[model samples]
Target: MNNKKPALRIGIIGGGISGVALALGLCRHSHLQVQLFESAPAFGEVGAGVSFGPNAVCAIAGLGLGETYLHVADRTPEPWEDVWFEWRRGSDASYLGATITPGVGQSSVHRADFLDALAAQLPEGITQFGKRATQVDQQSDELKVLFDDGTEYPCDLLIGADGIKSALRNHVLEGQGLAPQAPRFSGTCAYRGMVDSLHLREAFRVHGIDEHLVDVPQMYLGLDGHILTFPVRNGRIINVVAFISDRSQPEPTWPADAPWVREVSQREMLDAFAGWGDAARAVLECIPTPTIWALHDLVELPGYVHGRVVLIGDAAHAMLPHQGAGAGQGLEDAYFLARLLGDTRTDAGNLAELLEAYDNLRRPRACRVQRTSLETGELYELRDPIVGANEQLLGEVLATRFDWLWNHDLDADLTEARARLGWEPRSRGALRQG
Candidate 1:
């Protein structure tokens, strides 16, 4: 007589970093049947370079992707391994301050490369591509995920790891009789491109700018704009994102049907930073082709959980990129959710409560990060009324601004989450410590 408990059918929407990471974490358990549906035909990530602070690094490690991440992630060389970014005035290159984050400073990876590394680790027959989810139908015991192709998938639990424009988010909001919220444009557009590190070094030297800027990450701040550069691909390339903001409007806005990313000419990028200092101009000149990205973030949701459906990553709390914590928060989301769902005590009868515990533990922290990210962008662009470009005050704020975000203890949070679920705390060694 074979009397085994039925496996839980877990469906994950979207195949971005958080989705795949969560899938990987859940797959570690033999009883959880995980299936990942991606809108794209294959696993991929868009964007040039993504940096992770110490907090993100720990989350990545906690998710069992530490080796893969470290394999491709670029870190500052010795003597500057702790420097997050050196801040300078965009007009004159005068040093403002430097943010030193010990152990993991400006660690970054090309988006595509990191995603590829993560995708390689997935178990076979786990992911389906070209499957764009349109809506989710919640039944009494199971949820039906409808795709754009007129097909549907029935699962025990559904998780939305989709990007800013999420279909399952609509289901979650509508389930509670609330209207879905659209992503709000932050009135900031980033001009992004990559430059050859060696060539950029030569350009810096030719323009009589410090070559040291190329060796480590640097942020040049202006009145209404800021330019940041960090090494990627093992320092072979320098990724640059130059941001220009329009703050005239009292409230931020973006056309509903407008595209978020588009290609723009080098001339347009140059004109935006026309009067910047030699170092800033040198970095900009290296990129003959640049693409502009309209930055948008989601307003805080009332909750991330509604019955068996949950939202993670950008679907829950998309934010500005100023603090470089967006992806990290997503990874943290994956870590907590994966740990909670994979707990031995978690089962079909208690899944909803476990999810609530996950939301209770994660929602507040992620929303705080989201809010702080916007404020950080304002601080970066010198829009803060109090700081107002005061170099001394800016320096002091920069030194400790990321302390809370970076110094977070994920294990403790996991313990608290277990407590919320009325489960006894497990030792750190007993759980997968990444």
Candidate 2:
């Protein structure tokens, strides 16, 4: 007689960093069947560069992508290896402070390059492109993911990594009798562009600005606006994002039909930062064409798990990029969720308890990061009432604001999750052996 259990059918929606990382992590197990559905024809990341903090680095390593990430990740040069960002006043270029996080300062990568690195490791026949999930239907034994191509995929579980504008989000919320929420416009518009590092350095020299600004990651803070620059492509190019806020309205609002991103003239960008210090202008001058992005974040959902359907990454908690921890949070989600689902004790029979454990452990932390990221953006624009323009106070807060976020221990959470699901404690080495 031959008696063997069937593999768990797991379907992941979306193909960005979070979805791909989760897929790679789950694929390590032999008893789990995983498939990823992406809307685009091929895997790609929109945006210039993304930075990860120490906590994110830990999560990446936990997911077994440490070596892969390090191969493409960029860090601040020596002598400033521990500096996250040198903060300065945008008006006069005076130093305000710096965020010093040791060992993993400003570890960033070109979004597309990092995505490519992760996607390259996915097992063949595991991803289906051009599959955009339009709706999710729950049956007695499985969940059905209906794609825009007039096709449906049935799986034991569904994971929504579909980003801020998630279709599965409504399904999850509606199942729980909660009203579906829309993505909230943060009332901030960011102009993004990339510039050649050498050209920016020469501009600094001609403009008599500090050339070190080009080599190291920097944040120029001002009233109602800020500019951020960091190296990508192994220091050959610099990624720039300049932000402008409109606070006239008491509450955040944006038109539902308006395009989120649009092209704008360089002159418009220059005029936005007019009267700023030479350092800020020099970086902006390098980009002849720039795109303006209407920054939007999801309204916090009441929960991330409902039945066999769950959410991850921006689908659950999309936040502003002020803390540079948004992507890191997604990575953390992938790490925790993958570990739970890949645990030896997890099976189709007890999926509810295991997924609930995941929701209990991850929801609080990701939501907190979401809230802090928005606050950090306000602080960068000098809108924080407590630390407003107080250089000493701002410096003190900047030095340690990220300690709780970056110094988190994901292994401990895994242990707690195991206990929650009545599973025996297993050492990291033994868990990997499974």
Candidate 3:
């Protein structure tokens, strides 16, 4: 038997889905000792609605959590029906085409349930909650992490799954004489909320909305603003998000809490969306109270990995939610890292090589998605002919763009890496668990 001491001790900062999912990916490996640190009070995730496309579903299913995910969440057959649009010819309205066919199969879920499934798959006694990682120190041999409560831990590798506002990102860049910037407002504020489908239907009935309003996701576009709505939780609830680019003075800042705590009342919503279609008006009216999230995005890092520390998810490349792949890409990062670390040739001397391979495999693809998502955001705000043309092209070209992403198999990469290093495969399925 090829018995060798486990390659390295791994430490993960931040206990979000990315961290926990990475833990599950690394579970079958007895070669590495892993620790996950979180700032939250408990070992779970908190959030509202999110989408999981087939690419994301493939990653999760590969982790052996598909059945568990379905048990705790809704599994809709057709989650994405259309990308609706409204075009105005000098104030005259027209219904632009709704791109019904999508590149990937998708399902919506309450974000909390998705995280719970991943957390359940994690090995026991490995997660440390309420222990906020305030700092990371890169030593000559290992990386040292310091918590807010003055406790310290060390490991051979450090993974910053902390989030967009990652402390490790700053530490690594500053260590290399580069300063990282936090995400800033994108001049758009989103009003997000979820309501029961029955309530939505009743409200629409009294207000005279389109009969097909509840069928699929609907996007109402205007000049510099847009409204998006979709069904979730087995179609039990409808989630709505209204994005507006206001010209007035910027709004006041608020603490990071549920998106609903800072809502501009129903009256305010009506004022903002007064000129929108009646269907959107009814959907907005049905929302109990909408929480507002100021949209923000981060510029791509020049390097995603450095020395013993590497960044993943929002920490490495935070993008706008136009494609709804922020969380999915994070899951991809976790799975990709599992492939790298579990490789037969993954030794201390070649750790840098593994990191480079990971960056090379992911950065270009992710950056393309990031740029396309931004373009989609601009497309969503269209009230012009150009946007209509772009929408048609988007529907036609989406599949081509996502082919490599959706078809990627980390096991293949791991196998390739081992072959490149002249190592024989010990077991076909040893590198991956699910």
Candidate 4:
């Protein structure tokens, strides 16, 4: 009789940032057999620049990717290339108030580079590409996962990090007296792309804006929406994102089979930011072809755990990008959950309780960020129901609203969560956010 125990099997759907992060974290502890599936044929086509606050940078660093992240990230510090965020009255391009901060650790990275960094950290043969998940069902002893290729994987636990339109999300919500929900557009769409810094330099230089200032981040506030621009790829290119609330996506629901990204002409982009400042217009001029992204967010999920399956990242709580913390929140989820699951003492008997603990701790925080992101967008557009065109309060709102999001301490949060579960073992994989 062979009595060797089988390893705990973990099946993760979707290979976006969050899924990849979780796979990397679980791989740190050899007891877990981790497998990640992606719908795409391969990784590294995320199609945009991602900004991570100091808090998220610390999370990435704690995951043992700090040095690699520093190599691939845009860490151009301030005083040389200081970050300046100016809130100008959108109607005429007048400065409201400005906040200056050193760009030391708030790393903005190319999505491909970031994904590549994460994918590289995983052990060989762990991530399987082109596996689109079709169905997930919990059986008496294990969970069964089906793919489009007519293959099935039965595992001890399942995680649906599949992203906004997750098929696994649909599975978890099935038969809960809740009709599966689809993502709804936030009444806004954005034209985003990478613009060569040379084009922006020429545009700003001709306008008498300092050439040095071209590398810094900028925000152009307006009536219906705003323009946010920042440098990425080591200042080789600038990422430009211009958002507008007027663009009517009448069918606000995200189409399942349709591409969320489509090409938009320069004329459409120019017309979208036409009424904004010279700086905003200049940034728009640099984008020859822009990819329009319709922002969609979920209303809310009552919880994040269903049986042994848990939802993370966009699958659980998708939000607006106004805070630039959506990905950060997802990374936080990966790290926090990984710590709980990595504990050797955690067994099948307590797996349900531990997952419920994850839901109890993570859901409120992620959902709060979702609500905060919505409010932040309204404030940026000067259309806040509470502010109501009050420019003075708008400045106040922009100045310190992000302190909580940027300076979060993950180690402390996990400690509190551990106490809530009434189990405190010596720290294994947890690290304080430095």
Which of candidates 3 and 4 is the stronger one according to lDDT?
A: 4
Query: So what's the TM-score on candidate 4?
Result: 0.91
What order do you get sorting by lDDT, best first?
2, 1, 4, 3
Per residue, candidate 2 scores C-alpha lDDT tens digits across 1-434 of 76677889999999999999999999989889999999999999999899999989999999999999999999999999999999998987888889998988889999999999999999899999999988888977668999989999989999999999887988889889999978899999999999999999899999988788988899999999999999998899999999999999978788877899999999999999999999999899999999999999987678998899999999999999999988999999999988888887788888999888788788888888889889998889989989997878987899899999998888888887787677866455432100
Q: Model 4 over residues 1-434: C-alpha lDDT tens digits?
A: 98645678899988888889888888887667889888899886566888887777777776666787788888544554444365666655566766544454336889888888888878888988889988887877768899999888888899999888888777677735566878877878889989888988998888776564466666778888888877888888888888888535545555677667799899988887776667678778888888998888987887777788899999999999998888888898888878877877666767887887788777887888899998888888876889867888887777777877777777776786676566876365654232
Model 3 worst lDDT window (10 residues): 84-93
Model 4 poorest 10 in a row by lDDT = 425-434
- What candidate 4 gets wrong by more than 4 Å, as runs, is 1-5, 80-84, 91-93, 99-105, 247-259, 425-434
Displacement of residue 272 (Cα, Å) in model 3 is 1.6
The list of candidate 3 runs beyond 4 A from truth reads: 1-3, 44-46, 73-95, 100-104, 247-261, 383-434
Better of 1 and 4 by TM-score: 1
lDDT of 3 by residue, 237-311 (tens): 877887887545454343356342365677887677777766777778887677777777777667787788888
lDDT of each: 0.89, 0.90, 0.69, 0.79
Of 2 and 4, the candidate ranking higher by TM-score: 2
The worst-scoring run of ten residues by lDDT in candidate 2 lies at 425-434
Candidate 2: Cα lDDT at 377? 88
* Top-lDDT structure, candidate number: 2
Estimate the overall C-alpha local distance difference test score of candidate 3: 0.69
Instruction: Name the Cα RMSD for model 2.
Output: 3.2
